[model samples]
Target: MRGGVRVERQLRRLRWKLTAMFTAVTVGCLLTLAAVTATLDRRAEERALDADLSTRTAAVALTACFDPAVGRITVDDDSADSLVLGRPYLVVVVDWSRDPAGAVVYPARAPLGPPDLGALRGLRPRVGPGDRPVLTDLAGPSGGWRAAVVAVPGEGPVNAGMVVLVGDPAPVREANAELTRRLLTGCVVLAQLAAVGGYWLARFSMRPVVQALTRQEQFLAEAAHELRTPLAALLLVARGGLAHPARRVDAMRDTVRLADRLGHLVTSLLTRARLQAGTQRVDLVSMRLDQLVEQVVEDLPGADAVAVRAAPTVVAGDPDLLAQAVRNLTENALRHGRPAAGAAPVEVTVRDGLVEVRDHGPGPHRVGHGSAGTGIGLSIVRWVAELHGGEFMLVEAPDGGALATLRLPGAAARPTRA
Candidate 1:
């Protein structure tokens, strides 16, 4: 019982470790994906804002260039007013030729006051590959702003040399902030879900391991229980032989039988272990099933009390396993087939890849002589039959006895010589 508890604790620890590893990997992947998505979204928003600022600046500059007034530039057209009036940005036309300190032409009423002219004039206009004006970000008193600076080409009295358009970037920053918040929330939720899924997957994977361990523990307990009685009897017989010299011969004979029984029990346990652990491989060959059953019957201790009727039936199977299976069936029948009045002998039949053993004794539910043997023998028979793609079954016969059948897939019977 303590061993079982220790195994359970160990299995729990291993399960938790596997869950932790799986959760960590899942969260790492989710965080990486979120980071990449946030970055791409920020770049997309910046591009859009830059494009809007550039388009407004170009419209204002074009209107100022074609103004009818001369000796002084005035942007009084509807198009220029529409681009700058009541907008979330500032537009200033600087006349370097008129006043080197810079001049603001549009927006007669300044809300945030005039922008810093020295800073505006100091900025170097970025030209793209197509000679398009690229917007630049500037730090302002109120907040950060994106500015597009465009220079008028022709030298005329009406044309302002520089058109500076500045737009507040608060909206873009707010949008990016919101996007970041949503991505973080989504990542947290996904991480929780991943942890749950990982734990479930770990438990699912450990089921087979748990079952195998349980089976091993049960096998050990059964083996110990089965060995205890025979070992005690053998020891008692040896002690009695030493105490009484007259009964030494009988004691010696009984000792041999008990030792043989123990040996057989141990061998059966080992065979079961090998079959369960998959250490034993079935070697398939074409062989005569009837001959195998006959050989098994002939080797039994009470061969005279058993009757065999076999046909020329062939099957493809592992010869060793099949022989062991047949031998176990015959032995089990002989041990349990005796009635009080001495009924018919145990009947063994082989027909069309099937071996049938019918005992005219008590049924399977009743305990009889030699019933102390562990049921491992039947388990081995079942395993061998299954390995050869066949089956084994034990059923109560209608004639008040037990009938055991071993069925295998039939192979073509060998050709007889003329």
Candidate 2:
């Protein structure tokens, strides 16, 4: 018999494997999706901020006027006020035509006060044509700013120039951070759900294995219980034979019978195991039920004490297995029927694919007392009958004894059922 601890360990291993697999796959997919979404969202936020900066720069560039002869340029106050309202950061116009490069032109003076202008001066050197906006990060005494410069044609002093627009990126950063937090929470929840689902799936899948193991345990336990009685009987008979040499022959016969019973019990267990494993193949062919019944009665230990009235009954089944079933039923009747002198003989009837063994004695419970052979034999007979899509019954006979019956699928000496 397999140890219970081994079985439990095997089940636990399978469950953990399933849980890990589920969590890895499910969490992997969620994290991948979250990463992709975050990338796309960051790009989108940057694009929208760039679009806002480009719109403000275009408005300033369109309104500004420059005179070539006077070496002067002018920009609209309304445009500068619109850029600063509901927004943070400072703007300055820069001239690329200067000999040193990155020379402030329109804002020739700082309007936002003399905070560190180095960050703004650095950005002017990188400006190009207004076809695409040039962006950079600027940090000064006022705080951080996301700045973009777009070059535009000027009338005179500032011939090639750019309108710079700057804004704080705190809101966009907050939105991205919030999305990341939510996605992480979703990943944790999905992992929990996967763990729960995977555990139940493992348990459901293991049910068949657990049942098979349990059945094997029961088979070993029951076999040991059943074999004890016959083994004890055989030992007693051997001891008696040695003590009384005059009755040694009779004692030896009893010992042989007990040995035979023990062999039958073991064979029954092995056969059941083979059947359950599907290793024992049944050869179903056309055969006579009565012939098998008569053979069983003849082979029974106390055949002379039983009477059989069998008709020509045909059936479709494995001939060997059917014979075994009949033999088991006969043994059950002889061992447990408890017939007295002059009592009606144990009657076996076979007709129309049905076989019945009846004894004229009290019912099974009274007659089956102290007999380990009682239940196993009947169980085998019932199993055999059902294997061929037939039925077996154990009920009270008309003579007040137990009646065992088998109904197979065929007519008497006729073609078998399809």
Candidate 3:
């Protein structure tokens, strides 16, 4: 029991290992998805900000006018009011006509400090008459900002003035920050869900292994119990022979019989273990089912108790394992088939791709009866039938006995023995 528990605990740890592997894979995929999403979002935000700054700079340039009389650039009253209402923008117009061009701050209603004007001078504007507006990024004390510098039109050989418009990118930055937080939160939830799903998947995958292991442990315990009886009898017979010299021969005979039974039990255990472990190589050959059944019946301990009604059915199977299956079924019938008074012997039938053993026993009550190693014997027979791509069934006979059937696929044409 302790050994079985240890094996089960070890298997449980394997389940966790499988779960951890599954979860790690899921998390990796999710992390990749999150990274791609964040990168795309950042690019999109940058594009939108660039477009916004260009549009606003065009608006400022369109509204500015150069007065050659004053040699200064000025905005109309409406444009001046609108520009002042817009927040987080610095508009400056520099007069190229002046030596070291004089810079004029737009939206005069709103004050532009020395530092803001000083930052605008660092943003070089096009001084040529027809140069296109230049868009660039500017880093400030607060954060990053986008700027568009355009040459202002004037009646002069050289450009009379230059318009510089700068826009703060705080809104886009705030939106991207919010999106990142939400994406991370969603990833966390998805990771938790993946962990849960992985745990269940691991448990589901291990269910078959657990069942097979449980059956193996049960088989070992039953084999030990079966061996104990013959071993105890041998010990008793040996002790008697030593204590009583006159009846030593009788005790020796009993001991030999007990030892023989022990040998049979050991052989059966080994055969069953090999079959269950799928290590038994079945050399299938062309054989007649009736001949095999007759041979197995003749060797049975209670051979007289079995009546054979076999037809000539040719099949492809390992004759040795097939014979073993038949022997186990006969032994099972002899042990459990309790006939009524004058009832016919236990019947063994071979026909229609089926080998059936019917006994006048207590019908369905005989099923699951582990007494005298019946369960393991039937188990071997069942496994043999399945190995040949067939089936084994135990049903209540119509005449109130137990009916055990081993069905194998019949050959299309009988072939010569290989």
By TM-score, highest first, what's the ranking? 1, 3, 2
Off by over 4 Å in 3: 55-90, 96-115, 125-133, 139-142, 151-161, 245-256, 281-286, 302-304, 338-345, 360-370, 396-401, 409-418
Model 2: which residue pairs collide? none
Regions more than 4 Å wrong, model 1? 66-77, 84-87, 98-102, 105-114, 124-131, 154-160, 340-345, 367-371, 410-418
* Better model by TM-score: candidate 2 vs candidate 3: 3
TM-score winner between candidates 1 and 3: 1
lDDT of each: 0.76, 0.73, 0.75
Give lDDT: candidate 3, residue 66: 79
Per-residue lDDT tens digits of candidate 1, residues 1-418? 9999999999999999998999899889888888898898889988887888888888877776523356455564566657878776777776645674647645666544568766776763342222255577776778677888776643443334667788877777788889888988998998888888888999999999999898799778777776877899999999999999999999999999889878777877887799889999889988888888888878767788878888899789988888888877877777677653555558887887888888877878773335555376777789898899887888788867888888887622321110
TM-score of each: 0.85, 0.75, 0.79
Using lDDT, give the best candidate's number. Answer: 1
lDDT of 3 by residue, 93-163 (tens): 66656543356555664332322545555654434455466787766666666777787787756566677
| Candidate 2, poorest ten consecutive residues by summed lDDT | 409-418
Residue 394 error for model 1, in Å? 1.9
Residue 409 lDDT, candidate 2, scale 0-100: 74
Candidate topping TM-score: 1
